[model samples]
Target: MRITPKVSKAKAEPPLILAIDIGTSVVRTMVFDRLGRAIEGLESRRSHKIETRAQGTSEANPDLLLRLVWDCIDQTVAEG
Candidate 1:
């Protein structure tokens, strides 16, 4: 006599939660389901760095940072 093994499959659903982190040097994004399990993620580094020359000096390019943020978001969304 021969016996067959049974297999089970789980249902699939769309992701529920999305997390994004935008830092001065790096940007990262992640997607998670209702259970908080990560499904997709992406990270990218800034092309340019913001530096201060003096104790009171401060500088940053908002346009560049915005571009990097969009790039990271696009990549992460594409991975999904």
Candidate 2:
């Protein structure tokens, strides 16, 4: 998977925060300002699938999730 970050030229005023969300099938990364507002064009996202067994068991690969998180963070920072 490749991360295509949204590029923003305007710098975020100080006190920036990085937010990461790992959902059932998607991982997201965003940069927010002190006021809790997302910085424009500073976000990344990746989608993944979970394994579902016939016995009603759900499984997710930890290593894959970790890699997604890393990629999101790296892309967000690189864009910011």
Candidate 3:
């Protein structure tokens, strides 16, 4: 987050950008500035497992994946 100085000592804040990454085994969320630079303190991550079968097939539960993504988003926003 970036703050600008003003005559009255009040700070002008910049617009925030949130980024979410859902990978094969992990979900991650982070906050970034307009320039796409990540903010240092706003981030969340969670790992999930996929169901694998003996036939070399693997699957993930859609509901569980969605919930994990939402949880990451919520946690990251709370930090900001």
Candidate whose lDDT is highest: 2
Cα distance off (Å), candidate 3, residue 23: 0.7
lDDT winner between candidates 2 and 3: 2
RMSD (CA, angstroms), candidate 2? 5.7
Compare candidates 1 and 2 on TM-score and give the better one.
2
lDDT of 2 by residue, 1-80 (tens): 75534323365566888999999999999887766667887789999999999999999999999999999999999987
Q: Per-residue lDDT tens digits of candidate 3, residues 1-80?
A: 57622221122135666778888899898776655556776789999989999999999988998999899999987866
Q: Which of the predicted structures, 1 or 3, would earn the higher lDDT when compared with the native?
A: 3
Off by over 4 Å in 2: 1-11
The superposed Cα distance between candidate 1 and the true structure at residue 22, in angstroms, equals 1.4
Task: Give model 1's TM-score versus the native structure.
Answer: 0.59
Model 3: clashing residue pairs? none
**Evaluation by TM-score, superior candidate among 1 and 3:** 3
Please give the lDDT score for candidate 3.
Answer: 0.75
lDDT of each: 0.57, 0.84, 0.75
lDDT of 1 by residue, 1-80 (tens): 54322221132134455567666666666555655555533333345577787787867688877787778778766755
Candidate 1, residue 10: lDDT: 31
